[model samples]
Target: MGDTANNTENAPKKSFFKGVKSEFNKIIWPDKQTLAKQSAAVVAISVALGVVIAIVDIGVVYGIEQILKIG
Candidate 1:
């Protein structure tokens, strides 16, 4: 009975490792040029978004200061 329980617990772990190996075999990895282009695109968009948001935030703060007579 104890041996049966031990094997039952080990069965899932064994299957999990086998499944992991099979999945790694099936992956289609991106090549170097595609990877670089995608990375640069992500960075450019992120920087443009950050600059726009910062400008909007500064404009809001300046407007609020004018309303409160702080400037």
Candidate 2:
């Protein structure tokens, strides 16, 4: 009776870990070429977004300075 209770307590955690491992094994990860292409796209998009944000910031600063008449 005591052993049965212990088994119930531990079995769920063990099964969960086993299921995770099985899922990881079954995953078909992207190939190197695909990964590289995706990474490059991400970097390009990030750079483009940064440039846009920078332009907006510069415009705002210039406008604020002009309004205040302060360099």
Candidate 3:
């Protein structure tokens, strides 16, 4: 019957949501102090990498300009 088919279709969805909720409950979230330290580390590393890339770019451009002057 159509009612049985509809029940079977919705059964998978209900079980999937239950599994998702169970998994969410098992997660151990980081505390605020740990979160702040991790965030600061990420920002500091990003800034340092940006500076390095800029320095390398400037060097490459300068080298190319010097080569053009020679040619």
- Most TM-score-accurate candidate: 3
What tens-digit string does per-residue lDDT give for candidate 1 at 1-71?
79999887777577789999999999999999999999999999999999999999999999998999964
Clashes by residue pair, model 3: none
Looking at model 1, residue 20 earns an lDDT score of 95
Model 3 Cα lDDT, one tens digit per residue, 1-71: 88999888777677789999999999999999999999999999999999999999999999999999999
Misplaced by over 4 Å in model 1 are 1-10
- C-alpha lDDT (0 to 100) for residue 16 of candidate 2: 88
Q: lDDT by residue for model 2 over 8-61, one digit each (tens)?
A: 887667778999999999999999999999999999999999999999999999
Worst 10 residues of 3 by lDDT: 6-15
Candidate 3: lDDT of 55?
100
lDDT against the true structure, per candidate, is: 0.93, 0.94, 0.96
| TM per prediction | 0.78, 0.76, 0.84
Off by over 4 Å in 3: 1-11
Give the worst 10-residue stretch by lDDT in candidate 1: 7-16
Could you tell which candidate, 1 or 3, scores higher by lDDT?
Answer: 3
Query: Rank order by lDDT, top first?
Result: 3, 2, 1
In candidate 3, how many Å is residue 64 off?
A: 0.3
